[model samples]
Target: MSKTTRATQALQQAGVPFTVHAYAYDPNAERIGLQAAEAMGVDPGGVLKTLMVLVDGKPACVVLPSDREVNLKKLAAALGGKTAQMMKPADAERITGYHVGGISPFGQKKRVPTLVEQSAFAHEEVFMNGGQRGLQVKLRPADAVSALGAQVAELI
Candidate 1:
């Protein structure tokens, strides 16, 4: 058996039910979320992407629908922070120990506060990156929050 990645290992430890989907790499793919949705045969709306943002000068994670972009003002309000800004890719990599396309809300190298868009709750399961490129995990939104100790909010 192959060694599980940090994301998978965390899910297993937390007893969060999930299914792994793997697909061939398309070098031409532009958006990570779209790639995952296409590869997993799921609706773009049902796929969520993890974004790193700095809220009030603190690193935070925002999980949003793949089809939409994060609204910084709404995110700031949801987080009760004065401001929210996108984190630099290098800073994100340093904080999560994963590249931009492979960043998972769970099992990050550092425990940063996280918020998931409330829309995600409507879906039975959401597809998100599995700590590696070309791999994604299908899991309940609630389970994801529990695993990551994240807060659910209207962050769209």
Candidate 2:
């Protein structure tokens, strides 16, 4: 597959330095993020997963470590909303204009409130989906946050 994607294009347009890494994507894998980490021979904590969610019935994007899970109540509070839930897969795909495993916060079809787990900044570099299956981008945490205009919070 071509390494170029909307996500990559967005990053480039923003002038954020990043490196793309391609790996074998297993659609059947139990956990897509972990699979990417293992395929790239990196720590799961350094591989972030992009998730679409509904906070107070509004679309939002969240990026967190592969080894962690989002606490709905915490996420809700972080977003200053009363409730939060995982967006339906079909809804997520429709709103983001990318498949579940390929969604990236940078280049979604719609701009929404986005958050990156504060802890992720602990890592010098992190990997996230590159708007395509089997593709990921490695970049500085601060760069990703700035590129997406995402708030850093305790999302996990």
Candidate 3:
């Protein structure tokens, strides 16, 4: 796709090699993560979802596989924080500068600590939001880790 978004721009500027993937967005679909995986015909395990979580009231980004859930206790322990809670949709958007459904851990209005699930690196490449609904970016797991300053953790 020729369309550009903050996430794409960030990746480009950082010289991170990536491929863009786009699919029809279903506004009414209840499970967007599953829908995207189905639309792309890719393994759900290779699709990463960006989640904004608060670690002691400070926003942090957690990147994990679409097929898994973030273990709050594990995440908190990994971050060395006493508490962790998901950011409200509005708060996530406001903080990440992307809509809730399109948040990418790669680019944001501000930088926050990022933790990527350790298992995600098992995939050669992972697909994630491209800063907009219906758009996804495919990139090497290591490149994502390096470019985003993310630490691999047992978030799942």
Q: Using TM-score, give the best candidate's number.
A: 2
TM-score of 3: 0.96
- Between candidates 1 and 2, the one scoring higher on TM-score is 2
Which sequence of candidate numbers ranks them by TM-score, best first? Answer: 2, 3, 1
Q: Write the per-residue lDDT of candidate 2 for residues 74-140, one digit (tens) a residue.
A: 9999989999999999999999999988988878899999999998988999999999999999999
Assess the local accuracy of residue 123 in candidate 3 as a C-alpha lDDT between 0 and 100: 94
Write candidate 3's Cα lDDT for 54-154 as tens digits: 99888899999998999998998898998999999999999888876788887799999999999998899999889899999999989999989989999
Q: Residue by residue across 105-138, what tens digits does model 1's lDDT show?
A: 8789999989999999889988877888777888
Model 3 ranges with Cα > 4 A deviation: none
Q: How many steric overlaps are in each model, in order?
A: 0, 0, 0
Assess candidate 3 and give its lDDT: 0.90
Each prediction's Cα lDDT score?
0.87, 0.95, 0.90
Error of 1 at 33 (Å): 0.2
Could you report the Cα RMSD, in angstroms, for every candidate shown?
1.6, 0.6, 1.2
Best by lDDT: 2
